[model samples]
Target: MMKITVALLFGGKSTEHEVSLQSAKNIINAIDKEKYELTLIGIDKRGQWFLCDQEDFLINGDSPKDIMLKHKGLAVAFQMGKDSEQLICFAEKTFTKSIDVVFPILHGTYGEDGTVQGLLTLANIPFVGPSPLGSGIGMDKDVAKRLLRDAGIPVAKSLTYHQWEQPGINFEAVVEQLGLPVFVKPASLGSSVGISKVKQQDELFAAIKEAFAFDHKIIIEECIEGQEIECAILGNEIPIASAVGAIIPQQEFYSYAAKYIDDQGAAIQIPADIPKEIAALVQELAIKAFQVLCCEGMARVDFFLTKEHNVLINEINTIPGFTKISMYPKLWGISGISYTDLIDRLIQLALERNIKDKSIRKSY
Candidate 1:
């Protein structure tokens, strides 16, 4: 059998661009070299698509300018079209590499929000992770919460804000309604970017303002104090849930620093210290949450086990971080699936879905 040619898409135009590059590096490293041929594609912060071969992408410093400089001259332009239009130019030379499949290591915004998925759909290429609709909903915290709530799944009570809304409108009322120590997050970001935990009225405004800088919409939810649990969902039909894992953040909450920077940021409690019944319920809810958004390929369903011992669906990550340190792959690893095997399964699912899609009637 011929090895599948996987185009690993990463470094997208989003707040999590650096994180995406890190994830891509991890995925590229973990993919079984014997079973797959990797082609690395990067989207710079300016949204320029590039075909580049690099190893271990990392932030040069905290400054975006320094990060951009390190990657400045490495990008090769790419443009797509029908048949003859599919041309890529690098250093005034044209080349073509037909992609059998795509493994997008994108985290937030343009990557996980369905923009890249939509483009791939138009290109008639199979790509891993959620479908466009699923990706869209998964990327929006507000919408995800509403859907889970409607599906009879418990989610934290949340209040949403649009970016264009005036800042002075009855924030006190919102706090009164939702209660204090609420989490304020950008509706579309991941890796805890633009997320703040506010405990007081003064801090609430600052959190909202900071969150709005990353995205127009914001979601403020009452903090759910419990074990931070996560389970991985895979497959199109009869999706299977991996062993549940609980995250123990080393800070007041799971902030961006704790998620990526610190060495001892979180401790993973595999098969989380919960009752067998609660585990089963969490697994079932994870699968249900994945399907609610019409997800395919893979997703990481997050939850909060309350002090009362109730399980609540927190959110779903369609393109959960592929970093070896990331919870998604780690959970699967403990569930008897190797990182390489997990990648292979997702690729298989993508190809299977693409073939099925081609069989669908377009003129109906």
Candidate 2:
């Protein structure tokens, strides 16, 4: 059997760039070497792509923090050919090689928000994760909530405001509707990067400003008091949802620090201590959200479960974090799928979708 040449793309011009590095490191370690000939491609903060080496990290087993995307001699790039994909390495000149598939581990913005997926779609290459349309909607909180609401999914009441529209009046009226202790977040980001928990009217404007710093559009959500839960979904047409997981955040919310940097962080309960019916509902909703959003390979659907047992869809993460301790993989692990096997399945799903896509005719 021929080893598949896989390009593992990571890092990007996003605030979550460092987190992406950590995620890519975990992915590189878990991918089966016998099945894939993996090449490391790093996109720096400036959005420049460079060829990176995985030898040091693989051989020494370095910590995720130590695993930086050091630029190698040549720059790596991808392009679409008539019938195949080309991953060319450039130095003085250039050399091209065929890439069988791409496993992008980049987490936010330029990487996960459909920018790379659109490129891969144009190249007609098999890649792990959702299609460009799915990725775009998944990354945008405003668009996603609207779609879910239309589909009869329960979503929290929220308001969207662009940075330019901040000057408009009616702050008091807005607070009156949503109530106090709202969530202010950037419309298109993850890992709680540009998010703030505003408990008072005085905190509202500052929180909005903070979120707008990361995205042109900012969203304020009415705080739903309940347990934070997440469900992992995999596959294409008939995706499988893992057992629900509960999050007990040490901080006010699941902030960036609690997720990654802090040691005490959050206590994640696998097979969340919810009723059987609620778990079943979450599983069903997870698949429904995945299908409605057009997610193909994988996604992690998060929810807020109220005391009265009402499950409200918070958001969906198309390419969620994959660090060794991340909830997405950990939840699946408890569901009896090993980390390595989960990665294998995602790659297989990518190829499966690619074959189906190729069957369609462009002219017809």
Say which candidate scores most in TM-score. 2
Candidate 2: tens digits of C-alpha lDDT, residues 1-364: 8998888888888888777888888888898999888988888888998877776423223554444556554777787753453887787877777888889888889988999999988887889999989999999999999999999999999999887898782568778889888899999999999899888778888887888889999888999999999999999998999999999998899988778666478998998999999999999998999998878899999999999999999999999888766999999999999988999999999999999998898894
> Which runs of model 2 end up more than 4 angstroms from their true locations?
57-67
> What TM-score would each prediction reach against the true structure?
0.93, 0.96
lDDT of each residue in 1-364, candidate 1, tens digit only: 6987888888877877776766776787788999898877777778876666454344563432234313533445334544233325465555665678888887899889999899888777788988899999999999988888888988888888797774654667777878777888888888889888888778877888889889888888888888899999999977999999989988888766666666477777897998988899999999999988788899999899998889988889999977656888998999999998999999999999988998999896
Residue 322 of model 1, lDDT score: 74
Alpha carbon lDDT at 260, candidate 1: 61
> How accurate locally is residue 220 in candidate 2, as Cα lDDT from 0 to 100?
89
Q: What is the lDDT of every predicted structure here?
A: 0.81, 0.87
Lowest-sum lDDT 10-residue window in model 1? 61-70
Global Cα RMSD, each model: 2.7, 1.9
Error of 2 at 278 (Å): 0.8
RMSD of 2: 1.9
Error of 2 at 209 (Å): 1.0
